[model samples]
Every structure is written in structure tokens, then in C-alpha cells.
Target: MFRISQYLRELAQAQATGSYPTPRERHAKGPVVIWNLIRRCNLTCKHCYALSADHDYAGELSLPEVFTVMDDLKAFGVPALILSGGEPLLRPDLFEIAARARDLGFYTGLSTNGTLIDAPMAARIAGAGFDYVGISLDGLKPTHDKFRRLDGAFDRSLAAIRHLATHNVKVGLRFTMTALNAHDLPALLQLMQDEGANKFYFSHLNYAGRGNIHRDKDAHHQATRTAMDLLFDHAWAAAQAGSLDDYVSGNNDADGPYLLQWVRQHLPQWEEALRQRLVAWGGNASGQMVANIDNLGHVHPDTMWWHHDLGSVRARPFSQIWNDTSDPLMAGLKQRPRPVQGRCASCQYLSICNGNTRVRAQQLTGNPWFEDPGCYLSDAEVGAVSTPFETPANKHARRTIEIAHV
Candidate 1:
């Protein structure tokens, strides 16, 4: 994840320890696990990475099984638990698991589609003591309803946000950007302010599950650049105005170097310092710092790797499964410099992006180590061979930079 708000606001100085100063760049004590508590959802979202349906999925982990995993995670030194699902709220034992997680001293968070979170539900969420609650909103009412494939979804979700804020539950907006919803980002940011949302997460749509089926909707590189520019401007302005809102982007690690380029143009004096920080951030953590557990207790490197199963927690303890590295995929993911091919192999900013998202490469090329097709960076920016997806604007910008150097 790229912490745009932190970078723009300078919320914390990079703690230079040896070469890797940032906590993320340093070796983490344990992975932050994103646990899919259930596979049932009320609304069938167009880009549902879990491809959730209205009905319950068979063979999900039972309450006892969940408790066992929680204990294992706590004992294994897992720092945080992000409880997600088709819609985590649909889980019957959602609060029970959450309360238990808190008792176990885990920093737990809830990821939900806010349509189900009414006033009472919001109150329950606050009582459960979640450190954070992220609600997915694709766009403004009309567009969001279309993407959600349900009428009144937008209104219900908006109400849920207000309800969360009323109960003092720290809530944030989680928007998966696509060609279908990129136009609404500015309005969504406005909604964040109007609703007193504490954070905004701009997720680049990854090619997984339903998202893959609709890959044509992924935003164009030019559109992505435009969106990032808007976000940077808004975040910096908010910081100047003393607003303590947070902004994060995920799925595509290219945002890291993109942010650095933004800094070079807007805050040239701090460019070198930011580069060091990015290096320490260590790009994408995937199998290293980030992990995933599906509803059936299957372990994966990350949430997007739903198709790749490392091991089942029932058969093997999560701690053992995560550390074994016997699985070739897991072994490759754990490698510091992943054996990525094509453009990723030679990108100058490999340390900052870790070859972007490997899942994208795997989805398109049937090779986990291939270059990420979703990367929006130009050949010039990454200092690699010519990129096939380069836009005319990238060429213009490169030419302008060349002229200035001369």
C-alpha cells in the first residue's frame, strides 16, 4: 500500500536503521493476515475479488475452527487481523470473532460493504472495538448502484457511513478504481470530507475473480495518472489545511514510484530523502509481510492470490504453512528480488515496487514472474526497455524532461 497522505504530510520521518529505515522495509515480526470470515454477500458487486454470491458457501471454517486459527495467529506473532469476506457483516459470528480477537490482543479491522451497516449495526461495530472499518463505495449513487447491481445500494451505504461516524467508529472509504468509477473519485473524496470519514483507500482494480472477467474496465494508464495527480493534490492541500485524514492506494505498487515522481516535480528538495524512504518501504510485501486466509482456512501469499493455495490451516498450522516455503510459489514470493522477467527484470526502481503485482503477470501470461500488465509506468520512468502500453502523453513528458536536461 502507498501511504499518500503520510508521504505528502510527512506524518513521520523515515527511521533510518541501517539501510532500511521504514518499518515496512524492515523485516516484520509477522505477517498481517486478511482473513475472509465468510463467502456470503448481500450484493453481487461487479468487481468482487472474492466472487461472492448471496448464498452461503459450503465447507467454510466453523466457529471452533476460526477460534483455533485466531489462537494460532496470535501465538505466531501476527500483528493485525483484517476481517473481510463476500461481506464480513454477513458472517453470523462476526462480532464474536472480533471481540475474541481483541481479547487476544490483536489489532483487528473490518472490511465490509456498508449497505448492511445501519445505525444499530454501526453501534454494534463500535462496541466490538474494531481499530478500523473500511466500506467499499464504487462511485456516486447512480454509478455505485450500477456497479453493485442493486438499487438503493448507494443510499444504504451512504447511510452506513453516517451511522459509523455517529457511533465514533473510525470509518474509511475503500474505492476500487476502474474505468467505470474513476470519474467519481473527486466526488468520493468530497464525500469523505462531508461524511467525516477518517481515511480514503484508492485501490487499483486487480485482475482477480470477477475483476478478471471485466478486465476491460481497468482504467487506462493515462486515466490512472490523472487520478493519482488529483489524489496527490488533494492530500497535500488537506495537510496544509491541517486535516489529519489518511489516504492509501493498494493492488498496484507502481503508485510508490509514481508518488516519487510527483515529489520530484513538486517538492524537488526532498526527492532524495523520499527515494531512500521508498527503498526502505520495500515495494510489495506479498508473501512476506502480507498474507491471506480464505473462509475455508486456506492460506495464500496475499488476498489477490486466492487461486493459489499455499496450505490449509486445518491440515497444517498457519505458522508452519507460512514459514515452510516448500511450495514453489511461496518460495518465489519470499525471495527478496523475485525472479521476475521482461520489463520488471530490468526496472531501475525494482526496490521500490518489487515488480509491481505478480498476480497480474500470472493472470495474463501464465507466469508468476512476468511483468505486471497493469503497470502504468513508461519505459522512461522505470528506466527499462520500451513499454508496450506507453501513452502519447508519456512520450511528451519524456521529451520535455530530455529538453530540460540539455
Candidate 2:
């Protein structure tokens, strides 16, 4: 994930001579764990990566088991933990687990649908001292409700955000972009400003679980570029106006390169500095900086890889599973200059975006090394030149020279 707002601000304020500061390097000890405490959700979202339903899954970890995992994470020096779910608040011990995580010195965050966060619940969450709360709001009333597969969901979620704000809880909005909701982005940004949201997380749709069914509906290249332009403009303007503090994009590392290009064209002076900062940030951290532990304690490189299990916490500890490089996928993911195929292999900005999202490539092409189908950059943009540089006579001379050597 790239925090474009913060990076842009840093670049705008930085001195010309010195390099900007880098974010804390991840995966030195353990990946930030996105623990799915439960798999049951009230609403069936159109692009739900989990395909979570209203019914209970059979093998969710118990409270004691969750405590055990939390203890292990703390011991392993995991920097942060995000409690996610079909709807995490639906868990009976949600607050208790959150409190326990805090007690153990974890930077705990909550990811929820927001419809379940009422006034009293908001008060409880605030009192629990969660580091942050991210609530999903896809778009305005009609669009959001349709995406959520329920009417009145938009009003209820908006009410929840207001309630959380009233309680002084640090809350952010999570919006997943697709053809259905891309048009609503401007209105949604205005809503964020009006609602006084602390942050906005923009996610590009990834093909997984229920999302795979809607792959055709993913935003086209132009739409994606337009959406990103809107987000950058709003976020940059908000920073200048001293409104929102954070704006991030996820599920696609191509965003980093895209932002670099934007800076090159618009704010030419900051281009070099921003490029250095992005290279240090190192995009696409799955299987390295990020990991997912599903409701059943199965470990994956990321949330979208629910179908591809690396290991099981029930059988072995998370630290053990994450550190075991014998697994081919895990090993390849941690390698520098990853063995990626097609355009991603030859991208000029490979240092910034480490092969984009491997899961997307795997999902679309049935080979994880293939170019990510979700990458919105063009061949020219990514530095893919089909024709060879040498002429036919030069090529024949080179072939003759190689034959002499053979």
C-alpha cells in the first residue's frame, strides 16, 4: 500500500538536497497479521474477497486460541495486527480480543462494515483505545446499498461513521473501486471531507472469491487512471487545506508508478525525490511485509490468497509458518528481482513496484509469474518494446560471431 497523500506532502515540504525519510521496513521479524476472527457477515458484498456468508464457519479459532496467537505475535515482534472479518463486530469477543491485543503491546486496528457500529458500540470501541478503525463505504446511498446487497446500508454506515466521530475515535473510510462505484468517487471524497474522516483507503478490485465473479466489471484502464487522478487531486488539496491526514491505495503496486508519472508531469521538481522515496518504500509486500491468517488459522501471503494456503497456525505457530522458506511460493515471494513473467518482468519501475500483485496474475492466467491482468499501465509506460534494437544484418553478424564461438 502507498500512502500517496503523505508522500506528496513530504515531497512538497522536503529540501532539494537531502533524501526523504523512509517508512519502517517490514518483514524483518514478522509480517503484519490480518487476522480474520470470523467468516460470517450480514451483507453479501458484490466484491467480497472472502465470499463470506451470514452463517458460521466450522473451524474458527476460539477465544483461547485467539489469545494464544496474539501472544505468539507479540513474542515474534509483529508490529501491527488488523482484526478483520466478514464483519468483525459480529464476533462475541471482538472488544475483548481487541483489548487483549492492546494489552500485549500490538498496534491494533479494526476493519468493519460500519453498519454494526451503533452509538453505544462506538463508545465501547473508543473506550477500548483501538489505534484505528476502518469502515467500508463503497459509495453514496443507492450505489453502496446495491453493492452491499441491502437497502438502507448506506444510511446505517454513514450514521455509524458519525457516531464514531462523535466518540472521538480515529476512523477512516475504505472504498473499493470498480466500474460500479468509480463514478461516485468525487461525491464520496466530498462526503469524507464533510464527515471529517481521518483517512481514506482506496482499494483496486482484486479477483478472488466473490470478486472473481465480477472480474469483468473491474474498472478499465482509462477509468482507473481517472479515478486515481481524482483521488490524488482531492488528497493533495486536502493536505494543502489541512483537512485529511492519510490517503492510501491498495491491491495494486502499479499505483506507485502511476503516481510517480503524475508527479513527473505535474510537479516536475519533486519527481526525483519522490521516486527515491517510493523505491525505498518497496511496493507489493505480500509474503514479505503482509500476511493473512484466516478464520480457520490458515496462513496465506495476503487476504486475497485465501484459496492458496501457505501453512496452518493450528498445526504450527505463525512465526514458524512465515519463516519456513521451504515452501516454493513463499520462497519466491521473498526473493528480490522476483521471477515474474511478461511486462512486469521488464518494467522500468520494478524497484518501486515489486511485480505488482502476484495473486492477481495467478488468478487470471493460472500462473503466478505471469503479468498481472489488473496492471493498468500501457506497454510504452511499462517500457515493453517488442521489436529488437539491432538491424537484420547486425543480427546475422551477431549470430555468425556466436556460431564461431560455439
Q: Highest lDDT among the candidates is held by which one?
A: 1
Question: Candidate 2 lDDT, tens digit per residue, 223-244?
Answer: 9999999888877776667555
The lDDT of model 1 is 0.88
Reference-based TM-score, model 2? 0.92
Model 2, residue pairs in steric clash: none
Candidate 1 residue pairs in backbone clash: none
TM-score of 1: 0.91
Off by over 4 Å in 2: 15-28, 385-406
Residue 342 displacement (Å), model 2: 0.5
Q: Tell me the whole-model lDDT of each prediction, alpha carbons only.
A: 0.88, 0.87
RMSD of 2: 6.0
